[model samples]
Target chain A: MSAVGGGFGRCDAPRATARLEALTPFDRAGRRATESHASSRQLAGRTATITQDTSANPGDLFYLDLHTHSTDGSDDAGATVEGYLRWITGRRRFGYRIDGFVLTEHRRFDADRDYTALAEQYGVTVLRGIEVETDVGHVLVYGVAPGFYRDFDVTNVSLPYEDVFRAAREHGGIAVGAHAGRPRIGLAEHVDRRSVSVEGVGIVEALNGGSSDEENSHALHFAEEHGLKAVGGSDSHFVSGIARCLTAFPEPVHSVEALVEALLSHEYRPVAVEETHDDEEIRERSRRLQAVRSTAEAVHHEGGEVEYDHSVIGVEVEIGSAEITHEQIAAYCESTGDTNPLYRDEAAAEAGPFGGLVAPPGLLSALVQGRGPDPKVQYGNTTFMSGQRMEYVAPVRPGDTITGYASVKEVYEKTGRSGRMVFVVNRTRYANQRGEDVSANESSMVHRQVAPRKES
Target chain B: MSDAITQRYFEDVWPGDEYIEEHQPTGDDVAEYLHINQMGRRAQTGNLDGRFTDVAGAARQGLARPIVPGAMSMALITRLVTDWMGPLGHLRSIEVSFRRPVQHDDRLRANALVTDASDEDGEPTATLDVFFENERGERPVQGTAVVVLPRRTQPAPVVE
Candidate 1:
């Protein structure tokens, strides 16, 4: 018991379980004291009045979801309590270890059906509760006894809101506004209509899975304006929404007595469980992205061309594109470790054989980059540039806009010493803006599916 | 006799010598390299195509997010040592450990530090420690290499 004590930390805990456990509906004998029991209202309510505690003990994390619906006792319900339990703890759910839920049937409560066996079978707890539809809105009743049901006909819709809360109070039970902002039945809509004081409505379900965020916020704000405890519930009629919204107690609330104690506490907060990730990972990714973008821009400006596509073998695509200039020619020469005075010095070039600093042969790569069609093949994304057959048609000079286009000329499969491979023949033609063919490049790309290497 | 291959000999090389150079991976270069490997198919490679090509796909998978392949890191590590060795040297053995993922658009710099030198089988060998670090101070790749160099007396080993 100590291991599960003082959980969600901000909410109150059971100071004396000995006194509270006596009021628990499920007893050691697996029997409920629902028949004609005396109102332990003073003993229960007073002992459970909340204390102004801000920090809840870690062990007090009451993992129980306080609101759920079932077809077991309601004709309008879609899901069974048993099925809901399976899903709440199922594999697809990424189960957060939800302990139990209160089976709140609409306008109904069945004391004869002891869910003790079912709860044990599913390894979860199911407390008996009711969602009574009053003239104002729906209200959830916890700590409901068979005696209270016998005393009042709960099926009556016109049951005065004030009188119901008073009767619930007299019998040592709680009635919270369910889905506090859900239009007609919501507590917020009937706020000014109810003749009861704020004390009559002790709590409002501030977070309901079915309600919009705006509605939940309105309910929360309403609770703040009026001194009432704001709790949360899934208001779920089926699976999936079970623990999305929960009333996080300061301590584990495994039974009706513990729940009552925590509900009356000053600090049980409505919490929404959501996914969170590390900020460091996000920041590191951002840094890498910036670096890549800048480098790519610089690489493009440096006259290096890039292939735009490589999906289909026969499809024509742009492999590279570059505008040739004297500066670009010089930079290309410098990169290749070429020290030809004919290409570097303009005055010396005019006095030389070719005249006017004719661009070198290697300068063809930079002058006519790619802005033409490049083809892709159907091998694995791993291809080997096996061979290149290029023929120089004419000398490319400075200030020529060279565009290169490539297409699959031929493709054949062969089994060789390197294993089976698809040989893709690609033909690339470089043309200047003047429509003169600059160079013709025929290459073979080996298409092979090489498996990713295992990290050794 | 100007460059190291034509001028410098193995006897002139020394341990504790270090050199560093910057590497920048652009989207275009990565795209081109990856495209060159595409086995011309009607369909496409699954995760690698988008993950290594587009920013959106890369961002989805945290490791592939940099769109940099582990093989690329290994290649850089090899180049780091090779670029320093020149034509007068022959690489004998290389070993490396990939520390993290590299991505396209990373500011990478490779550092080669000559760690040891010795005569193995009458050959003058220099062992170098190589590592690449990105701008965020993450060492994505690190390795060591042993290369046999041509001495004033002994001939350099031939490359296979």
Candidate 2:
């Protein structure tokens, strides 16, 4: 139910508006349910009528970042598809214009993963491309087809540039040289020093976000002399660097096929994110986004310093255990007023299911109270339990010994209305005497700095 | 544990289907929960001094009135799910976040909404958004639950 392939270009006016109006409530609810696990395909089916207004002038340019990487499809990338969408949503909320971004993950294209639902949720157009290495350097490919995959080994570090370029065009795709001015990996350097001639190459990346100023200048000049059109890409492996450099198209582009047509037909130009976005907001938000990367990294806030002991993460330790006895089961039932005969009267329970007495599932909460390694999160002076998650695999029967193993699952910081807060998640796994997992739980604790109260 | 309650099948549910149950926990209910949990003896309690059960104890922790114990709230939620799932349905996991306090004697509405249903990996399961709401329209406790329910086409697992 998204505008992925339909929103771009001028369509029937009155009909599109009517369909959009009918789909508005569903789309809004979908967005509000942030944790809704509705798959992209389901969302696409649900919001098929969601579309951008045709009220805009057809002459208006649509801006898109042509190159980016995400952790889902690239090993070297640190940003997730959702993370990029969140950061982009943050920028768009401030009235900045960033139409969309292309996830040109290095060496692979996940054709099965559809991001149409995410795009509709974030109100940002999401598309996919691939960045591949060749004999001349790295190439950015868009609108890839099944034939393109059969023609080239994208993982190869020395793919023939001419054939890759020819095959890309033959398969209804377009290829552009990536980071064209960098040494060893740039087509500009190879062309200048080794006289490497890449035929039918009409585009090269001129403003790669990761490249130096001198390198970009060299690329810009190389494109001018070669009569090749220039595009810009962030080449970002991190979420904050997304859309640092962008390409402006003279027409709407809502899909990879449309993107290819726009790039080939329109005379596009490169634009930097700083040209339109507020520089300070970018810096502050980027800082906040990057701060959540690792526990070893720290971010200062007005309330206090936020950091944690990262060493305890993933390190497991024995948190002790307890053997479930019939007496213990009876006590648990008595405490909770759960007079179910299965847990209280052992002989009568034998005539019923479970063969004998069994402890209530909630007994795991009381039994696994052993202490584990503290993350020592350094944030607010006040700390409290935020929540608890328990996964029960099997019932606890009498005489079964249950052991708990604990570890620090994760630690991170978030800024909320109350002020800056740090969350530490500790996880514990409970196993029976037979070494079968009985259950697992994660306890989340929030640490916040409470200001001193004024005397009444 | 009872034969009177019919089993709920995975196919019989859909996202947004809601289940509601209300409870008004009195002072005695709170007291029983405290004694059952042993208030402090079992674990390192941070209630200042009986804050969860006594007003004087709660006042010391800046609370005007005694609040319902977190474990009691979790137990209520678990019971809500168990009652709905029936004997054939299994409660795989439940996670709860306590946003605000539920005061003693306050009528609490426990709600469970099926958020998603899937048979991925051949194990039919349903995800639910569970919460406790006071009359003030505040969700004092909210979380998610994942459960495995019997499929009508498949025979129920035998309890030996």
Candidate 3:
């Protein structure tokens, strides 16, 4: 609710919500009213009907990123629901008021995977929607209901756009053409060349974060000429890109039902997140990333010979031992956010095949000693753990005394794109009090030679 | 109590099956993990390169915050596999490659895709491709895991 300029102002919430329902759809009366609005809104000459009243109350305009993807549902999306929330919270510090974002995952909707708890924790309203491929282009469907899926196979890559548009309205949702100016998929190209006209299609994404300025311009003009209403979305597959463009509504939207109702009100507009003067946070993040990368790069510098004690390659020695306890097992689960009942719930464990609470396979790192006999490899200026392989022979339970025996498995040199590097492989075996081997681990470390300095 | 303790039989699984679980590590969680692994001593010894303990240390290394240890990242993936396999399945082997640093407070999703499931050499086993994907959609940690599970019908016990 922060000010972007003198243009936005907060109004009484109860009055705005009441007025919005009168202007939207829900019950019999609202639907009848909306049918008229929907029909008039669809006309290609309804441009003059759009309200440009400066006297309209701003209310609490909810700014929501209408399109986003997440790894939980979208295969190509890199952002998580929580990641977006955290980034949004960070943005709020800079006075950018991003109320929420919709998860418009590609091709599917997991109705059971709810984000209510996460939304409450972050104080951000989370809603679910879907983006499906069609003959015309990709379409963003908000407020998807179960009945909609029954009518259309949304997973179909080549769904008929005409049916999708009608079906969305029938199911209490809205379908907006996504990235409307992009090539091949956008509605603009189809309308211009193929004379493709989608009846009942009303809204198109006018400001997509992923779309180029020229592409967005094309979509804006397309909407103007077609007399289509518009919404905005980030179309963001990543965290930072979220809310770059969003739909600003006149009333607060807390659910899919409210979102649909508000869109039908035709009082919302696409708005970009205005940049603030105190955006040092974003700059600092990139700076840190650069630092981490450069530090890593310096370790991969070229030109050095590998040296190590050859005799210690196969020498085995006892490293250390620790008694596994139930308390330790519980603490490990808590630290890792592991909610597996078999590890924490004794009653559940007793009913299972194990017949008792067993430590997680990962707990071996804590039980087994970290340091083993050094391979004494003298090579590079940088050393790091490259990889680890572990084999569990048996389950380790509480009251088991675990002991680790270690040895230098091997030391070898390899050349990669980076340069010459020496790798030391260390092997460790964990045993119970009865001296039975429970697991074995092989960890490899890489030593990279320092790069030769440049002549300045 | 978690609802993930259900039993999974060897015969019920298939190749190409995928399981995803999310884990968000707080700064305290990372600190405790390093402490439990006895790596906290590095913090006391002034060896902090801003890797996994504090913010000031992270800033010195050009990091916005402390990072989760690679070992902890591996542990999270292990939990993902175990949670999916349930109590009946036994984890036989896991090999992981630490591809990138996972910063503290980063939300991660562990993904496991079953590559092969078969009864080989009288033992039923499943091979899975597992990875830890950060919010940035990058697989910072990934590898393969082999698990052993009990068949629904046991073969006749050795009569020797």
Candidate 4:
């Protein structure tokens, strides 16, 4: 048995190998047609090059762009299904063999669009997928079929994020948090890593084309901390943005179903840029694509971008609750060296002022510390816990759960020795499951943009 | 009550100790699970020949008829070991591969054998190699689980 997770490499399934040997052979690159339901063409096409997994691990493998947008259904995309295939074919000239891309249209899966001819001609795979805007953030849903489009009103963006993930689970698909490191639409931005860690979302976008380097770094860190699977997606709405980020699966996956399995099994690695041609070309293309998007609005549905403005104040919402474990409390006390007998000993706590094994002050702050209800303030890329004040209302005894609710009580600008800092003042109320207010905290987060590497 | 397992402790378990358990999943149970979980989202619902699961839909897609959803089988297998672990047993990890399908009304048996006993993060943990098999003895699910068990002689501090 594996000690924990990770360190499991792919093996050449001997049965699969024997079956492949029984089929007719095709010329390398699958240019020549062979017998066996055109099956040999697929297996022989890439199986010989399995060791070239993006992570450079010798294993059964394939590569594909996990995120792409199309004008057929999305208002923000520049390309048709065929337009993308043509572009993918063009990339082959640059010696980048892109196997395929999942067309993540905003709010809809465009189940009717047929790309068989285009896919075959360009030797690329084009699968339909949905990019949903949930209450928390945007998630990418793959393997959405025709019935799903009609039944779920796939065009609707009002579905709650948790519902979207549950639906994806039911349907045998996964709802991966898209561009999780970015602001507003990203999962890591609004929801704390602790919440996202326990939730059904098992995958996150560690590398995204539109997000900055630091934003992607935040996503990578979040994924590592939570042991969540990290994928790199282009999030492309245009030609140049395609394949900006890719996932290399250990085994050659022929369809989107296989891709989903690879993601869930943690059998893939994120790959960014096989070859760096130029950024100016991509930026120019993005500008041109925006123009195309503007024109294509007539043919497609619009509106799916979440931007947080720090303009609102006194906005209260629920920050949800986390179930605490005995071990977690121990870890916290270990870090802070809180030896308060009243906090640890039940006998002492019973004698103390109206308390039975009350939680220490650090636990309350830790419960309230992570990002509260998103103040939607985007002052900088890095979020730092600047300061906090805790007022102990009651005690959270053992066997009690803590639920947190927060409001953006204040938002103000400050300029100290360290440049202009945006302080988002939040008031969080922590309550035990027993309807007792445990602690109330007012905290400030200093959001300051990190200096660029060259500038520093 | 027929398969009631004796409560076990960290010190009581030895490698290669085997246990067997069984569960029968019906179509109605699946319907309730789907409906209660609100899992009837577009991806996994529809054509209920009595709340037919994704396994039922798989037949139309050229797969076996009325095969059980992988998650459903996983839930069953997880319960098999968890029931034995009692309240103090904290399930750490369950890693399984779906080698085949388990259809509705297929009474399945979970076979578990203790693989190792060691300390993880200062806690006593046991690893078990678990497998689920049908009446035909064909294994559909097989994996390993790591669980932290409470010490029988000593008590842990209350820190909840």
Candidate 5:
């Protein structure tokens, strides 16, 4: 059983010593884990504890879970907005202090009716925002009004992609690509030359609640290549899920204005829980991969450049009809920390001009596309997602078994600031259970040659 | 009724004085807690990579340093007060908030105070304030509580 104590400095003698003795082993193990994951300890290295007194000071560092959701917008059945507020306020019988939280719901819902009053009541800073799921990818628009783009039809609108980007910028909002990589949901199509030249987006999601290390690495590479600010989020729908992933800013930001300024200034780093691994063990596994035969075949070869038109590269598969549940959408949003109401609340969606519940554009991107039971791709080499360019055609309603098909369009090599990199482009088309095209996304990937000495 | 103490009764009193208790949280404790709660089980089940680093990375970023759940702190405080006041002590209220991030290797000390005690409607109740601090003397958790304790039984003086 764990021991107990008083409010502040009640017990200073035996209790203090006993506490130290009990903590020694845990402290040692934590140190070892921190040491093992040294290379990826960017956020851990910058950790500075914030106290209530220190938070009053302007320069004190604070960690903010920039992306969060609540039951008010999304279909988070387990937690209410009040529960979330109390959980973070450290005022409940069992609570914890969160510097602040941004109330980002889907554009389909009203933030004022659902979250604003609660924020005021709780005395916690709430940044009004939305996670716009566009054709290209999910973009987090912070510091915007609750209904800023309520009338905009993200899927069918003919406005240029830049117009939407500018809309966020005009609203003093930061546009961040949500989950740049993680197989189904990332924006791997936006990095194409045509898309990059046209969109000019500025932030990338480096850590997502639902992504793995490999997915995070893809996001990291995108941030590095595009010179964009990196952000992280738990994408929580359940109250307990908040703060899973956070951005530790160099200073405290207690308001929407300050949050926007922090993002604009690039003053934060992504921090998650640390992992433990031994060097030699990982090295041994890499050594084993060296024995696998290369499946390289050249369709065209020229001056130090070989183009492989591998016959098996463009395999097309159909994804059959499947039900779209609110739980699935909520889970996806929670994983990404997007709380857009169009995906969560049925009444709000019905009351909307669209007159129905609509999936967040991000969820559309996340849903698997491919026909048949065996549609998995065995990708060789690093799958570095460059960007996404999406065009939403229709609203994907619940109980719709969306059909999807994917085909590889091109593969090529280019030399950039990071030396020679290979780019592979894939196009995916989505249709409703009725066999109508609802959206299409073109995804791009870049594989860099890992120098032998620098291999992970 | 004054001499009878039940678990429910023990949870009902609130004290006014301050007190503290310290605890040590272990890695196994963390592992068990997460396993039971399934906080980040989805990521763990999806990623089959054998490296503990991968598991920890996913769990940490997904659930705040992969330590015990914050709710567990409340459960501990309830147990402490109940054990001290015996079965007749009833916990009336408990309010705790996390002050600092609690990691795997940190030792936690819970301090509490019984500030008020009185007889109401033939029952004795106490109000208390409490909090939990880490090894560095940082308050990772804080709250106020109230409990009702049983009084000693007395013979009828008039009849004697």
Candidate 6:
């Protein structure tokens, strides 16, 4: 309560005098009596009263990290549930307060298997959720029961998108279209007149970490066109990745219920990417390379004809010479809500046939950008992300600042119901600090040029 | 008159009615309502002192100033009917739609009119029209209710 009190202050001389003059003796007496009541009673009454306040106040602002992962699932640096909780609560202990966090693992893991139990053990409010990687797009379903994910078969269930969206809503959670415009099987490909007909969904991710300028812009345009609340995330995989794109509201989020209400009411604003970091240039260049690499990768994988230096290119390319440290991988996994220990569990990785820690396929793409893109230019887009098609040619261990270089292998154009689209093929070569090609990625993206109609 | 009665019901009643119950909502009520309902605070939590100051200002604007939840009004209507009809009577149906914004510090009344009564399976069923209006003669919620009443000879259950 530094300069910010519990949203109250003593009136200045004139206002105080006016208020005193306006009060009758009975009113003054009653006020005194009320003030003289016990402190506990006052606190209880205040708590009850604040619940009904409909106007913005300084005390009403609350913060939550809706997406987080542990090392219990796939594609992570092997940080345990407790380790993740310690990292998060440690921030609060050091004075950065967060209301709560949603543990959203990928489709392969169940939140209840380890995360929820550990959260309960730590006395933290953790919502059980899943970040489903559909063939068409990525969707984050929050506040859902543990068994719900199982009901929707990750492999075989061709459940209508509406059914999945409705199920998430019925269980007292929200279904957000995550990273809508990224190169893979994104929401733009899955969503149409049929998908839009599903009601009760009002949120969309307008920004994601590692997103390209074009992809982000597409996301923003989509959110605006559909009249939805735009959300943003770092899609971080590490502790440093927290707050990449924070949602700010007025404060004192007393419970998870209030937090949900805040989101549903659209009483929040997405913290732009540019506003997130201190270093502008580092983020900007990193973002550009991310776009270029992802674009080029998409082209080669889509079977498009791209004649480039494939012999010189390795399986994966590290953009800048940053060590592929164990710490970096672990942090990346945590921030992005990945919980698989194969990356973090050195013992497990060695015991397995791979004989060493292997990075998740998605991590291959994410790690290429390293820290994140320039935050300023990062604003304005709603994000829709898809799973990556990564091949682990070799083991990537700790203390490896893998240098990655990517080339646009080819470019093509196609026409769909959406409109004219351009596809870019990207091939990336990865090497250790020694500059040896360790892994490679061939990815493709189909960019739609036509802008979506704005909805009022 | 019967048509009006048919259109409204006792169970569907709220506060702020014109011909039945009359009372003026105050600044304190508005503040209490907002605080309890968690409606307008932009911040995550509520502020007690701010509520006190703002609620008073809202009252001066002639609105319900601190309009309580419609559920609260429904509860009050239920209490009123329960008291008049006795404990053996069961509230069967209640339907209400908020027509206009109800603000803080507005004088309000709750009203009801019995329109239909019939005997079915030895039980008496009554239909009543209900309404809620402010001192300014505006209806905020209006609807109807159906209730099943026990025989007059049967004593209502007593709890010690």
lDDT of 4 at A101: 85
Per-residue lDDT for A1-456 in model 5, tens only?
222332111222111111122322322112110011101111111111111122222224465676776656642212356655654542112212345566565433364464557778887666656665554445666766534465355322122345566776776666676666433234543453224442457776677654444456566666666677787775554444455456767777877778878888866776442211112221122110011111211111111443555563667655434456776666654433233344567775565434666554444544553322222223223333443445556667777777667777666543322233456766778888777887776655555442222112
Q: Per-prediction TM-score, chain A only?
A: 0.47, 0.50, 0.50, 0.48, 0.45, 0.44
Which of candidates 1 and 2 is the stronger one according to lDDT?
2
How accurate locally is residue A446 in candidate 5, as Cα lDDT from 0 to 100? 59
For each candidate in turn, the TM-score is 0.36, 0.50, 0.48, 0.37, 0.38, 0.35
RMSD of 3: 20.5
| Candidate 3 lDDT over residue span B15-130, tens digit each | 43445555667777777776666632322343435458877665554445667777787787787677667667778888776645677767665666554567867778876667
The regions of model 4 sitting more than 4 angstroms off are: A1-60, A145-151, A193-197, A275-456, B1-160
- Looking at candidate 1 chain B, the ten consecutive residues that score lowest on lDDT are B1-10
* Alpha carbon deviation, residue B44, candidate 2 (Å): 4.2
Interface RMSD of each: 30.1, 12.5, 17.3, 23.7, 20.9, 29.1
**Cα deviation in Å at residue A157, candidate 2?**
41
Candidate 4: Cα lDDT at A185: 57
**B18, model 2: CA deviation in Å?**
2.5
lDDT of 4 by residue, A329-428 (tens): 5544433323344455567566444346555444544443333456676556554444444455554665677777778877654332123446776788
Q: What tens-digit string does per-residue lDDT give for candidate 1 at A1-456?
A: 011222111123322211223322322111121111111110110000011222333234665667787668753234567656655443112213466788887677877878888889877878877887665567888885566687676765445567667777677787888876554456665564433355688898876755544456566666777877888777654343466566666567778866776787786776543210012221122111111111000000011122334455566676655666787656544333334454567775564434455555444433343323334444444654444434456556677777777777766543221223456677778777887877766655565444342222
Candidate 1 is graded, for docking, as: incorrect
Expressed as tens digits, the lDDT of each residue in B1-160 for candidate 5 is 1111122232232321223334565655454433332332332343422111233442433223434444344445543454344432334444444333466656665555443445755656664545555654344554445555654453211100
Name model 6 segments beyond 4 Å from true. Answer: A1-60, A76-78, A89-97, A108-111, A114-125, A155-159, A189-200, A249-260, A272-456, B1-160
User: Taking the tens digit of each residue's C-alpha lDDT, what string does model 4 give over B15-123?
Assistant: 4344555545566555544443232122323433322465435444333445555544554555455545543455555545454456676766565545455674688
Write the residue-wise lDDT of candidate 3 on A1-456 in tens digits.
011111001111111010112322221111111111111111110011112232223234678889888878864454568767866764564345688989998788988898999999999999999998777778999896799988887666567889998899988898899877655457766677668895678899877766645556667778878998887888765555577778888778999999988878878887665421123332121111111101112121223345688888878888777888888887787676666766878897776657777888888776566456776888765565667888988778899988888899888654322335577888989999999999999877777553433222
Give the per-residue lDDT digits (tens) of candidate 1, residues B1-160: 1121122245645443444445565666565444433322112322363556665554443223446554444444544454466434545555444434567777665666454556857777876656665665444555556676777785543321
Q: Rate the local accuracy (lDDT) of all candidates.
A: 0.53, 0.65, 0.65, 0.54, 0.46, 0.43
Alpha-carbon DockQ of candidate 4: 0.03
Clashes of each: 43, 5, 2, 6, 97, 119
TM-score of 4: 0.37
lDDT of 5 at A35: 11
In Å, residue A409's CA in model 1 sits off its true spot by: 74
Off by over 4 Å in 5: A1-59, A90-97, A114-117, A120-123, A145-151, A154-161, A189-198, A273-456, B1-160
Model 6: DockQ vs. true structure: 0.01
